[model samples]
Target: MKKTLTVLIAAGALLGAAGCSATPQLTNEETCARVKTVVSAQSATSDKAGMTRVANQLRPIKAAASEDLRDPLQTIIEYFDEAAKPTPDTAKLEDMKADYSAAGQTYGQVCGTGQ
Candidate 1:
């Protein structure tokens, strides 16, 4: 009886360990689908408040991006963050735009869409 109980406990421990293993990572396609949803919500609004809203919307895209697109999405987020600032510097904004555009072009090459 003791031997049988020991075997049952070991089996239970193995089952629990298996259940606690890390979740399966998202595929590039799955990550892109989630990114698309967040990107679609972005608008071309120039006002600080509007840009702030867009930045908030874009926050999730960074988290959902695949490895290939992560840096580009991060750059885009930084652009939005800068644009949302109350007193954004024009020169800095231009620099950020260049970075954002370059990253966007890279993303386009990979994802087939710049927007």
Candidate 2:
């Protein structure tokens, strides 16, 4: 019984250590590179499917992003998500365009991109 308890405690300690060793937060440069890759890959596609794809691809990147990068990434993701809907509202799309552009501008500035 004592041996079993000792083994169990050892296993629990191992698991606790593993749980505490989480993935490090992405650096701004790494996040920027990933965003650039996804955006560049999806840039040519303007259809609903493409928009959805872009949003989906960005979701994880945004989720893992640093605080400073989150808002612009979210804005871009939202724009793509809304654009992907069937019969997206034209006026709404127009309204979102400015924000989208600004977000893109923010991303470029933050990421040091020529985009």
Cα lDDT of model 1 overall? 0.74
Which digits, one per residue and each the tens of the lDDT, describe model 2 over residues 1-110?
A: 99999999999999999998865678889899888788789363788887788888888898888777889999988888878888788898899999999989988888
User: lDDT (CA) for every model shown?
Assistant: 0.74, 0.85
Please give each candidate's TM-score: 0.64, 0.78
Q: Between which residue pairs do clashes occur in model 1?
A: none
How many backbone collisions does model 1 have? Answer: 0
Q: Model 2, 108: alpha-carbon shift in Å?
A: 0.5
Among all windows of 10 consecutive residues in model 1, the one with the lowest summed lDDT is: 35-44
RMSD of each: 4.5, 3.0
